[model samples]
Target: MSEPKSYIQVLSPELLGRVFDAYAHKPDEEKHLIGLETTLFSSCESGFYANPVILSHVSKNWRNISLDRPTLWSTMIMVRPIASHIPKVENWLERSKTAPLTLQIMQTIPDDDTPIEPLREERTAVNTILEMLLKHIERWEAITFFLCIGFLPAFAEFPQGKLDQLKSATLNLATWSTHPQVVDRVFRAIHAAPELEFVSWCASFFQTGLPDHVPWQQLKRIELDVNDISEEPSSVGYVLDILSKCPQLTSAKFILGFCKTTTPKALNTPLNLPNLRSLALDEASSPNIAYVLQNLTLPSLHTLNLSLFSDEERSSANLFKAVGSLVGRSKSTLKYLGLDIDDEQLLKLLPFAKDVEVLRVGGAKTKKFTSLLTRNANNKISLEVLPKLEYLHLTYAQDAMRPHRISASTAALNRMVVFRTSQPPATPGLKKLKFISVGTAASSFQTAHITLILGTYSHLNLKSVRFEGN
Candidate 1:
């Protein structure tokens, strides 16, 4: 009745689910086999979620077992087949009796060209059910909490009066519409409660109604991610005005934005969040790049990832230059930096940071970026410039990967480790090389690497060459 097992592994697509069925239906003996951590089909995205919910349809036995794996059910957010998922998830909650659950919900923004906030047919139904569930679970003393929604602002309207029940929450509504109101309500609710500790709003919390300064001595971490700062004053900078007042705060997130001198400060005084341990700052527009770089001051900041992932070309180059110029200015507090600038940008930053130990840059994006600075000067992008540089990372593409040589003599370059897609560039001063994406296979990488290895370095007594995915 069954074909002989083939060379290729033919595990049943529903193998895990079927096993789960046996455990949930029969008790005791087999229960240990179907643990909560069983791998579900997550890669197919829609199908992954669908399979779990659909399993309930096959038999009542499945319905009961599926509930045991709360992780799988909670992982279900917004997706196709959610219409069918409604009843299944509702049933799971009904049986769960509000024991307290943390839901992760998100809306994928397919791409830039995709229309903003395109309404799906079931948007209202889904939101209505989720909100009702939030209220109902609280009523039943059921522990259900959080219907975390992402990319969808309408979801903000769901928990309306029931936010008091949530344990942890994240609100990242980027639009100005009613997002501020949602943030206002969420922040007020959290401020009043002792149970709720973790709260991150995609909208700026300090920028809104609680005043540019709140008596937030109790606050620990605060993040303000700005999507449109260059646009005519969306709430980004308004939030910063309020954030300046959150003194003694521990962690902070700032989205670079500017305010016109004429416009009143969203709050009267400058906001300072002291005792920050980690921080993330970004710039979508290039205009404020200079001011943002100059204004960035984190005394206790240990980890840093400065970025310029902008689509603006002309402003991008200038932004890159500004970011580069700010590097060495800080007193070497940064342990990590995720830079998305080009060669010209890196060269400008070299003189600034004397103690920067770790650096991660895009693959061959370095070449195009590197080419900018060398355009006028010698073709050298080297350690003489970055005297204290330690780890150097490159994001490589299918094309050949190489870096501009500043000086083949600096001891720092000699100590630097290179990670790339193409074979490592051989340099006399180069120390260690790690190839992240080598071409074809291990066999082919050898000859190409051999030729590249011999051709890359001078006879200045170089370090060893490594084949990565080996």
Candidate 2:
């Protein structure tokens, strides 16, 4: 034991810190950790540990090395900070030194379904931590809030216009009230941050116009998930007005639920976003989604995701047509398209997305998906549509209208694969395919079927084929 030694023990502090930094900030793991505050909070008090804490516990030398590295402690995730953890929070701040901080503050009531007001002692501890951080506001790189209605007043005590280093902010508000005035005040305070470039807001229930004093023109990214966005004419107008103001935006996402009406005044003038590159719309009504698309001219757009959630059979066709029209308008630049639509809508829009390199289609449509891959009455492959398509992802839902059609779709898909593979040089064909199905039955093509299909097209160099089912 006395003679035992490891190679890592010989590394310099700088080199060890670099290794620890990489281990602590694995990009994908950090992304997963960002929205998982509950898990982090629970683990904080558990014997299981991660990151700087674990590194410090390894040995005396390692502990000194970990403490000397500021990057390892710059991010502080405060999820329901308790009075007992004040000393720990203070120690973390002290160790962080002057490194730019990314703070995520989420206050959730522990072990209680009923909403009770925050205890005075808990408020005092939160204020103490916030007051300490406020002294170094210039080091704030990003701040996120997952606050309940009751904690909003406590958050309002921060001094104004102090975020010189701030670049991003996220607000996730969970409140039963229809009108959350605190949301407006929060945005007002955010507006005071001159360097803020990205903002994401998720309000469980929001019923108000855009807050005043937002630096809309300077923002490069925006995300909004609000209920009843298109319920009122005024709300729709405000949304459109905000979009019009943000000419520098390169990416945007929206989730508007239960849109029952339209705003004619908002749609009167089209919004031109020449710089936008990525747009994602989720659970939006046909009219509302089309209204937003019709008004935008996305010359730089390359990625588009339209996850439609409408039950109106007749209106869905119109929505699909509008989307097709929008794609036609963006044909010069569009390259990636993800759609959740039925086969009929897919057929209607396929021509517009001929140039799309990557395509993902799902939601009760895969049953009829093979029909699109088949040759019409003619004996030739339908390479005219999606000639540039390199990647295809198909998802099968168990409750498709015609589950019996699965076999037919599978047959058609096999034929399409064979015919496309057998084509002469200069003809582009499918390079990769991903099949994911959710059903009790064998909804996706079985391994044997795939092997048989590939055997017939052995000469074709298929890049990859993945099959997943549940």
Cα error of candidate 2 at position 19, Å: 4.3
Q: Per-residue lDDT tens digits of candidate 1, residues 1-470?
A: 98797532353435555565443333332122221122222212221233345655665655555555543343333342235546755765555453454444343323456444443534444565566455553332112122223323443654444444554456444443445566555456545544443455553433442333233555566555543323444444544544455566566666653333232323332233446556555543344434444444555656655544443321433644444444434333655665544455555654454445555553224333333212112234443333334454443323222221222222222223222111225433433322212222211223443335334444423233332321
Which candidate number maximizes TM-score?
2
Model 2 residue runs over 4 Å out of place are: 1-19, 27-50, 59-65, 78-85, 109-112, 115-129, 152-154, 173-185, 204-208, 226-238, 263-269, 312-314, 319-321, 327-331, 373-381, 390-470
- The prediction achieving the highest lDDT against the true structure is 2
- Regions of model 1 farther than 4 Å from truth: 1-74, 94-100, 107-120, 136-168, 172-219, 225-231, 234-242, 248-251, 257-274, 284-287, 309-332, 350-358, 362-470
* lDDT tens readout by residue for model 2, 235-260: 33445667788999999887655444
What are the root-mean-square deviations of the candidates from the true structure over C-alphas? 11.6, 6.3
* Consecutive 10-residue window with the lowest summed lDDT within model 2: 39-48
Candidate 2 Cα deviation (angstroms), residue 455: 16
